[model samples]
Target chain A: MAAEPPYLELLESVDSFPHIDISKTPYIEDESSSFYQLLLPNDARCHGYIHPSVVHKLAWTASFQVSHSIPRTVQLLDDSDGKDTAAACSRAFYEVIEKAVDSKIYPFLKTMQWENYRIVGAKYPTVQLLRSAARLFGICSRGAHMTAYVRTNDGIKIWVGRRAAHLFTYPGKLDTTVAGGVRAEESPFECIVHEAAEEASIPADFVRANAKACGAITYVAKSSTAYGDDSSLMTPVILYNYDIELPEHIVPRPQDDEVEDFYLWDLEQVKQAMVNRAFKTNCAAVMMDFFIRHGIITDENEKDYLEILTRLHRKLPVPTSPSEA
Target chain B: MAAEPPYLELLESVDSFPHIDISKTPYIEDESSSFYQLLLPNDARCHGYIHPSVVHKLAWTASFQVSHSIPRTVQLLDDSDGKDTAAACSRAFYEVIEKAVDSKIYPFLKTMQWENYRIVGAKYPTVQLLRSAARLFGICSRGAHMTAYVRTNDGIKIWVGRRAAHLFTYPGKLDTTVAGGVRAEESPFECIVHEAAEEASIPADFVRANAKACGAITYVAKSSTAYGDDSSLMTPVILYNYDIELPEHIVPRPQDDEVEDFYLWDLEQVKQAMVNRAFKTNCAAVMMDFFIRHGIITDENEKDYLEILTRLHRKLPVPTSPSEA
Candidate 1:
C-alpha cells in the first residue's frame, strides 16, 4: 500500500495549543455590576472605561441606554427620530475620542498613522467615525485575514511572517501571510485583495484567482488593555478566514514595515510555535483553525477535539440590523 | 444593481424551526440515579432501558464496568491482554442481540434491512461488535450528512426530500438531500459517497468531485422514545456537514426506499417547512446549519441567533480514542 500522505503523518502529534478559557474573560453587558464595563485599545492600557455619561457631556447620549437582551448593554436605538439622536451622538462621540487622543490621554494612540475610517456592527448603527487605533475597543470590527501557503513535494509549507518588534500589541509575534481589518463599505473579498498587496506584495489578480473561502473564527476575550484593578478590557472579534495558494516561485516580500520578515515554515514548526506562544494571541487561533480544517488535528491526537472545534466556531454577539430593529 | 437573490429575500421571514431544548433532554450516565440510564432505538421506545445484567444470560459480560470519567457508565476496557475475552464477549453480545431482534424484541426494527455494521469509538477498544440496531444504546456513533444545492439564475434553490413513510423512525418527515451514519470501517468522505449513491441515486463520481467540507455539528439530546412509565434513550451524534453543488441537469432519483420523493424547493418554502415541523428533529438542525452558514439567518431576523447557533452545534461527549485510552 502507498504510504500515508504527509498531512496525515502530521496529525500524529499529541501536542496542542493551550486551551483558551473564554469564560474567564470579561464581557460587555448591560448590568452595571459587570466587570470591565467598557473596552479599550491594546495600546491604551491605562484609560478607564469611556463612560456613557462622557458622551452625554456632548448632549447626545440618550440612545446609549442599557438593554438586557443584548450582550453589549449600551445600545443604539433604531427609531427614525432616535436614529437622528444616535447619528448625532455618534458624530459627537467620534469628535470626543479624537480630541482625547490628540490630548494624548491615550498615549499609545500616537504610535501609528490614523486610517480615517469607522467600524460598525450588527449590534448597533453608527454614523460616528474613529481612527483605526480605537475601533476594536467597545465596538465590533470585522477583519479579513489570509494565510498563504504552497504545496511542496515533501509537504505543505506556510508562508509565515512576524509582526514588527516596534508595534505596541503583541510586538514581534507571528501573524498570517496577509491579515487586515475590513474598512467601512469594503467587502471581505475586497479587503483580502488589498491586504494581500499591502502586507505581502502579492498581486491582486493572483490572490483573487487563488484564494478559497475557509469560513471564519470568532472570539470574545480579555485584552491586556484593562485599567488598574480591573482584569482587562474585553474585545469581540470576527475574523473571516481564507487560504491562498501561492506559486512556488512567487516569494512574498514585505510591502509595509508592519511585518518584519517572512519565512516558509513547515506544519510541525507552526504547530510547535502555536504551543510556544510565538504567535499573536489571536493569530494562534487562525493557525489552529487551519490545522483542524485540513485534518491535521484529529480525535486521536487532540484530547479536546470537540471542545476546540466548538469554541473555534463559537458565535459572537451580533448586533441587530437597523431595518430589522 | 442586480435583483436581490431569492435566498436573501427568504430571510425576511422571522419564523424558525421550533426551538430544541437539548439541555432539558435526559442523559445516559453511569450514576445509578441518572435520569435516562440507557438507549433504545426509536422503534424500541416502548421498551424503556435495557438492564445490563440481562447480558449475563449469554455469559459474555465482563467489562461493562462503571467509571467516573467515561461518558457511558458502562465502560469498555482497553487492556491489550484481555483482547480475546473482549472479542468473545463482543461476539456473544452480537448473537444475543440478534436472536432477541429475530425473536421480535424490537418489532419496529424488523421493517428495515440490517446492514452488517458495528459501532466503535475511540474511548474504548472493542473485542465484540453489536448489530446496527443497538449501537446507540451506550456508545457514541458519528454520522456524515450532505446538503446538496443547485445554483439558479433567480437565486440559490435547494433539493429537498421526504423520508419514506414505512421507515421506523421519522417516517414521512422532510430531510436533507442525503444523510447516513458512518459504518465501522468507512471514513466520513467514503460514507458520504456511499450514502449519496444509495439514498439519492447521485453518481459516486459526481459526489466525489463536488463535495465541500463545511465542518460538523455536535448534539447529545434525549430521544423521545419513552415507555409507559419510563423515558427511553439519550444519544449523542457528531454529524459532519458537507455542501455539494449539483449541476442543473442531473435529477436525483431515490435508489433506496429511504427517501420517498425529491423536490426542487425554494428557500422560503424550506423555511416555512422548518417552522411547521415538516422536517425530522435532526434534519431541522442540518437545515438551520445550512441557513446560518449561507447567511440566510441573520441576527435581525432571528432574535436568538447566538442561542440557535449554539444549540445547533452543541458540543457532544467525545470519548477518548482507543490509543489514548
Candidate 2:
C-alpha cells in the first residue's frame, strides 16, 4: 500500500505547477481579490483576464488537457449591441486564450483533450457546457463547488486535499475536498452536500450556513501535451461559499483513494501553517483570507497572516522571469 | 362555431358548481375571527386544523382553496432535514387537503384546472407546490409571480386582477397580478416574475431591481363540514414591492382571459375602488391598505375609502326580522 502523503508535501507539490509569464502582460491587481471580485470589471467594459503565465501555472498544476488551436480574435468594443455584449466578451476572452497558447508560454502544459468547455448558452462566459468525459467520470461543473468551514473543539478545521495524479487538472494540487462543479439541474446547496459526502465523507448536514455568494476566476494559458492541438484556454474557476457548523461528534474522513490524508488545525495553526508554507494551496490561502475578514477567524494572528501573504505574493514566481527576458 | 366568450361572462360561469358548507367541519382557524385585530403568525409550525366555516370565509375571500383533503402522511420536514435552518423553515410548511371526491370545493375551488387560473402550477394555498408547478409549466419563475409598480405616462399604475373563475379556490375574486407563493426550490424574486407573466402578461425585462421586502401574511381556516376529518391551512400569499418605468407608448394590457379588465387607477382611483361597497373583493382591500400604509396612495379620495372600510368592518351583518341568528 502507498504511504499516506504528508499535508505540507501535498500542498507544496500542488503549488509548484508551471505558471504563465505575466511580466510583459499589462494587468492591474486589485486589493479585493476575493472570488466575488472576479465578477467585477478590473478596467472598463471587460474585467481583467488572468495573465497567460498564471493560467499556464494553474494548467500545469491541475493537469488539465488542451485540445484545440484557434487564432486570437480580441476585439475592443467602443460601443456595441447590448444584446450581444455577453457573446462579444466571450469571443474576446477566447482570443486571449489563443494568444496565450500561440506564445508557447509553458511548453510542459497539457491540453484538455475532452470537449468540456463550451460557450454557456445565452449567458456567454457565465455559463459553460458540462464535459461528457468529466460528467462520466463524475467531474462536474465548477459552479457547484463549495468551500465549507468546519468548527472543531480544537478551533476551526477546514478539510483541504490534493487532487489525484490521474486527474486531468490540478493534479497533486491542494483543493477543497467538497468543492466542484454543480450539475445542470442541481441546487448549489445540494451540490455542496454531495461534494462533502464524496470528497470528505462528511454528511450534508455538517455544513453550517451564514453568508453565501457566487464568484468566478478566469485565466489564460498554453495548451497541454494531452491535447492534440497546441492552443487552448487554460483554467477558469468559479466558486461559491457557504458557512456550516457541524456537531462535535461528526468526524471527517477523506476518501482514501482520492485523498491522501487529512488534518484538523485551529484557525491560528492554519494561519501559521499558511505563512510557514505548510498550506501552499492557492484556494486554501484565499479561503483563509475570506474567513479572517468575515470575522470567522479574528485575532492578532490574522495580521501576521496578512503580512505573510503580502510578502509571499511579492516573491511568488511571475510568468516572465528576468532570465527569460 | 362557438362565439368568443366575453371575458367577465366566461369567468363568472366557470365555477358554477354548488358551494360546500365548510362551517360544520373539524377545522382550524389562523385567527379567532376575521374581525379580530390579530396578526398572522410567520412561523410555519403555528398552523392549526381549522373550522371549515373559517376556511370558507378566509379562503374564498382571499381567492384560494379551503379544503382539508390532501394526504397527511407526507412529511413536511423531508426537504429541510439536515439542510440550512432556512431550508427547514421553508420545507416545514404543509397543508392537509381534505380528499373529498365530487365535493364542491374539489371541482370548483381546490385544484388548478383552468389554464387562465394556472399561475405555473396549482395556485391554491401555498407557494411551494405552486412554484414547482411554475417550473413544470416552463414559465420564468423569477419574472412572473411578483407584482411591480410600473410608471406609465399617466403616472404609476398598480396592476391588479381578479382570479380566474375556474380556479380551485378564490374564483372571481380580485388578486394581485404579481405577488404569490415562493416555491420550495425558488427564491422570492423568481416567484414574482412568473406570477407577473401568468396573471398580467408583464414582460420579464419590465421588472426593476431594488425590491423592498414588505414581509409576509399567512391565514389559516378549519373546515366546518368534516369536523373530525381534517382541517385546512392557507398561507397562499407573499408580498413584495417593485417599481418599473414604462415608456409612453406602452399601454397596459391585462390578459383578457385572466383579468376582468385593466384599471389604470391613480392613487385616488385605487383608494376609491378599494372601499367601494360594491368592489366586493378582499384581496383588493388588503392591497389598497398596503399601498396606503406605504404611502404609495395619498389623496383625499383614499381617506374616504378608509372611512368606508372602517364603517363596513364595524357594522356586523344585521339579522332581518328576527329570522337570522
Candidate 3:
C-alpha cells in the first residue's frame, strides 16, 4: 500500500501561518461560514474561529491573561451561537481532543502545543478531515465537543491564551488555551484530553474528573472589526465540566511561541479582578462563574465574578434571535 | 425512470395483504448472517438483525397487552441497548413514518387510520439499512426484536403478553408484545409502532410520545419451562417512558389472535402487581422502575411496583457470555 500523504507535515512546514488573533478576531457573524456558525449554543453566535497559532500565542504571551480572555471568548462564542449550540460545541470540542490525543498523533505535548501543533496546527490529517466531515454533517448532525477545567495550588486557574495578533479575529486577546474544534470520529472525553495537553501544557495523566455536561450556547457576529463581511449565522457548542487538581507549586508555562504571558491567580483575586474589570477579556468573566458553580473557587471576591457570570448567563437567552433586540 | 418500480404500490400491497402468522412461520436463525449486538441498560439481551416479520410479530403481540405485557418487553429491550441508541431508534422511526405519510402513500386515510396504520404497517428503509451502516460507522448495535411500549392517558405504558401454548421461548407465559429482533432498516420507534397497530389496533397518533431511552442491560436466559431447547437464549428488553393521552371512555382492546386479554392499571398497580408476583415477566417489573424514575408515574401503587422493580433491578447480574449471552 502506498503511504498516505502527510497532511500534517505539509502544514508544519509553513512559516507565519495564518493565525486567529484573540483580540482582533471579531465575533464571527453567525452566518459567516458554517465552521464558525455551527460551534455555538442556540442562544449564542459565532464569536470567531481563531487560528490555532493565535491560541498558542496568547498562552505564551500571558498565561494569567488567558484566565480572563479565554472565558470571554467562550462567552462571546456562546452569545453568538445561542446557549444550546455553545454548550454543544463546548462538549464536542472536549470530546474530540480527548479522542485525538488517545490516537497519539502528538504525545506529551502541552495544551498550547496540542492546540497549534495537533488541532489548530493542522499537524494531523485526522483533524482536518474531521473538520470537513463536521461541516458536512449539518447542524443537527454535529456531535458535542469537550471542555476541561483545571485548578492548581498556584491559584484557581483555567487554561487560556491569546490569539496571534496577525489573525483575522480577536488578535492579541485571551482565549481558551486547551480548547479546539471537535473531530467527527472522537467523543467528548477524548477531545478534552487532547485539547488540555495541547493548549494548557496539562498532561493526560493530570486529568482527574469528567463532570456533568454543562449546557450549550451559540453566538453570531455581525459585520465588524474582523472578517469584514455581512454574513451572520449561529454556532452550536456543548460544554463539559471537568475538575482537575494540580500541585500548588506547579506553574503553567505557556509555550512561548504560542503564548505571551501566564498568570496564577488566587480564586478570590481572580473573582475580584473580574468584577473590577481587572481582566481584559470576557473569557475570564465566564470561567469565573464556571469555577464558582463547580465549587472549585469559593471566596468573597468570587461573588463579583459570580454575579457577572449570572448576569451573562441570564443575558444569553435560549432561542434568541436578532429581532429580539 | 421506469415508473419508480411502484414504490407506493409495493407499500400498499404489503399493508393490505392478509397478516402472516409469524408465530407459526418457520424461521431458522441465519448463523452465517452477520449480526450486531447492542448493549442496553438492564440485564437483558436483545438480538438484532432478525427478519422484519418477526419484529412485527413481537410488537403486535406486545401491543395487544399494552397495560401489562408490553411494558415488560420494552424494559427488556431498553436493557439490551443503551438509552441513547434506543432513543435514536425511536426518533428515527417516527421521522420515517412522518415522511412516508407526508409523501401520501395512502390517501383518504383518516387521522386514526393514519396513526394506527403508519405505526404498525409502515415500512422503514432507513432503519432496515442501519444495521450494516452502523457497523461501517463503528457504532455498537443491538436488536430488540420482541418488545413494545405505549403512551397512555396517565403515563407511558409497556405491554407484555402471556405467550400462547404453541409458541417458542417463554411459551404460555408473560412476554413482550411489540418487540422482537429489530431488523435492518427498522428503528425501535417504527418497530414498536408497527407492533402496536398490529396487536392492539391502536392508532400511532394515540402514541403521542416515543420511547425514553434509559440505557442497556444484558442478561442470559437459559432454556427453561418456556422453551424445550436448553441451548437457546432469550434477550428480554428495557424501554423508555412515553405518554399518550386517550379519551377517558376509550378502552384498550387487544387482538384476540395475539393476546389472551388486556387491562389498564396505574403505575403503582402495575408495580405492585409485579412485586406481589401478579406478573410473570421479569422484564415488566424492571420497566416500571424506569417509568417511576423518569417521572412518568407516581403514587403508592406505582411505588410498590417500583420496589419490586428495584429488587429485580438488583438481582440481575451482568451477562457472563461474551456473544449474545
Candidate 4:
C-alpha cells in the first residue's frame, strides 16, 4: 500500500453526516419534539423530517392531522384534489413558518432566501419548500455544479471561483465555476444554465449549448455553520455535475457579490488547493469526481480508487425515487 | 408520476444479493458449519467469508489454527514472515483442496482457470486466490470493462458484443465490447489493454492511447447460473469502466470463443436492448452508467436518474481499501 491520498479525506469531510434509520428514530406529531414528519394528502410515499425547535412554534391548525404514533407524521388535511392541492397547502404552511419563526430561536430562518426548492422523490404529487428551510427539514435537495475549463497549450485549465467572504456558508472557500441550488420546477440542465449566467457571468445560450450533464454525486452532509444552527443537519443533497469546454478567449468575471474573483488554474494547482482544504467540501468532491472521469486520477496511482468512486455516490438511506405503483 | 422506466429494473436485477450481517451469523472454526472467516497473520483489518459446504472437506492440518467461537476463523500458522508467508500458506492450502476435493460435491472447482485474482483490502499483505474460488469466499473481485463507440454523422454509436453460447456464465447474452477479470499485480488499464486484444482483436497501442478511464460500477451480485451452484453465491465485483472513440474504419471482430459477434448500434437501439434485458445484468449496468455520464440520460427524461447513479456505485459493506495505518 502507498501513502493515503489527500483527496480521500476531502470526500470523508463532505460525507461525515451520519446515517439515520427512520424505522428506529423517534418521531413526534402532536406533541413538541425534535423531529417531525411532513406527510402528504393522498400518498403515503413522501416523507420529510424537520427539527422541533423550528416546527414546534407553528400553531396546530385544523388543516393538519398529527399522528401520535407515527413520530412527527403531519398529514395535510386539504379536501381539494390530491396532488397539486396538497402541494399548495404544504407550500402555504412553509410560507407561514418562514414569516413567523424567530430568527433568534432558529438561526436558519435568518439565512432564508425567498427561492423555492421542490422536494425530490415525492410521488403522485410534490411540494415546494423554502430553500433556507430545506436543510432544517431533512429532504433530498437537488443542485447543479458545472466545471468550466479551457483547453490551453499546456493542457486543460479549469476556471475556479473564490466565494465571497461575507457569504453565510463556506465563506472564503474555493468553489466550482458555476453552482447553485435547483429552483422550483427547474431541470438540472436549466439550473446549470441559470447558475452559469448568474454566478460566472457566462451567457445562458453558451451554457445551454456547451454544458454537458456528466452525472450526479449524492451524499448526506451535516455542518453546524452551513445551516447557521447548533444542531447539525441531515442535509442530503444530489448535485448533478457538468463539464463545459470554453474557447480560450472567453474570460469569466465575477457577476455578483457571491464570488470575489475567478482564476484559471492547472490540474496540479487545483489538486494542491483541494489538499490544502481551500475548496468548499462539496465542490472539492465534485472536482475529485471530474478528475476521475477525465482519467487524471486512476486505479493505478490511487490506492483508494474504487472506494472513492463508490463513496462519492453513496445511496441515500431515505427514499430517493418515486414509488412504483 | 410517469410509468416506471425499464432500465431501473435492470439495475435492481444485478443488485438483488442480500446483505449479510457478519456479527449475527454463526461461524464454525472447529466443527462443520456454513460460514468461515479467513484471518490474516498479525493483521485484523482484512476479513473474508466462505461457505463451510466447500471448506469442511479440507483436512484439519496442523499448519492452521481454527478458532472455535470465532465462526470458522482460520489463521495460517506461518512464522517465517507476516504478509507473503501467509499468502503462500493460503495458496498451498487451496492447491491441496483443488487436487483432493471431489468436483461433484464442489462443482465450482471444475471451472477453475489458472488465473489468479489478488484479494483486495488485505492490510499487512495480500493473497492471490484462484479466480474460480473468488465468490465462494466473498472478497471484492476487481475487473475492467471498456465501452467502444464511434462518432458517425448520424450521432454516437456504441459497439456491443454477444457472448458465445458455450460460455459457462451469461451464455449468449450481450456484453461490453472488451472486459476481463484483473490478474494479480495488473492495473485496470493494463487489464483493459490485455482484454481488448484477446477479446476484440484491437491493437494494444491503440487501446493504450485511446481508452479513457471514465469511472467504475460496483454491485453485490448473486445468481445460481453465474457460479454453477445450488446455493447462491455472494459475488461482489468492482469494474473500472472505460470509454474509447474508435474511428469508423476500425471494426471489432471476435478474436476468441468468448464472443460470438459484435454490432454497432445507435443510442436508441442500445437503450432498447437494455429495456428488453438483452445485456448481461452487470454489463447493462455499465452501459447505463455510460449513458448517464455522456448526457444521454437526463434528469428530465429519467425520473430515477439520481437513484440510478447512486445505486450503480453502491458502497460495499466489506472493506474495499488498504488499511490506513
Q: How do the residues A56-80 of candidate 4 rate in per-residue lDDT, one tens digit apiece?
A: 5555566667665645576766645
Better of 2 and 4 by TM-score: 4
Q: lDDT by residue for model 3 over A91-142, one digit each (tens)?
A: 4444544554455432322122222111211111122223322211122112
Clashing pairs in 1: A122-A319, A123-A319, B30-B73, B90-B128, B122-B321, B122-B322
Question: How well does candidate 1 match the true structure, expressed as C-alpha RMSD?
Answer: 9.2
- The runs of at least 3 residues in candidate 4 whose Cα sits more than 4 Å from the true structure, single-residue gaps closed, are A1-5, A19-38, A51-84, A99-104, B1-5, B19-37, B55-83, B99-103
Q: Worst lDDT window (10 residues) for model 2 chain A? A: A33-42
**Relative to the true structure, how large is the alpha-carbon lDDT of every model?**
0.57, 0.35, 0.34, 0.76
With a 3 Å backbone cut-off (N, CA, C), the pairs that clash in candidate 4 are: A27-A71, A27-A72, A28-A71, A28-A72, A29-A72, A37-A72, B27-B71, B28-B72, B29-B72
Which parts of model 3 have CA positions greater than 4 angstroms off?
Answer: A1-167, A208-225, A272-292, A295-325, B1-325
Please report the candidate that would top lDDT against the real structure: 4
**DockQ agreement of candidate 3 with the native complex:** 0.01
Residue-level lDDT for B173 in candidate 4: 93
- Highest DockQ: give the candidate number: 4
TM-score of each prediction? 0.62, 0.29, 0.27, 0.90
lDDT of 4 by residue, B1-325 (tens): 2233377788889876664444344632334544667666656643566556545655555666776564457665664454467466566557545654454555766766667777777663346767777776667788899999999999899999999999877899999999999986788899999899999999999999999999999887764654556555566788999999999788999998899999999887887787678898889989988988998887877877877888889777567777442
Between 2 and 4, whose DockQ is larger? Answer: 4
Q: What are the candidates' interface root-mean-square deviations?
A: 5.4, 31.1, 21.9, 1.1
Interface RMSD of 2: 31.1
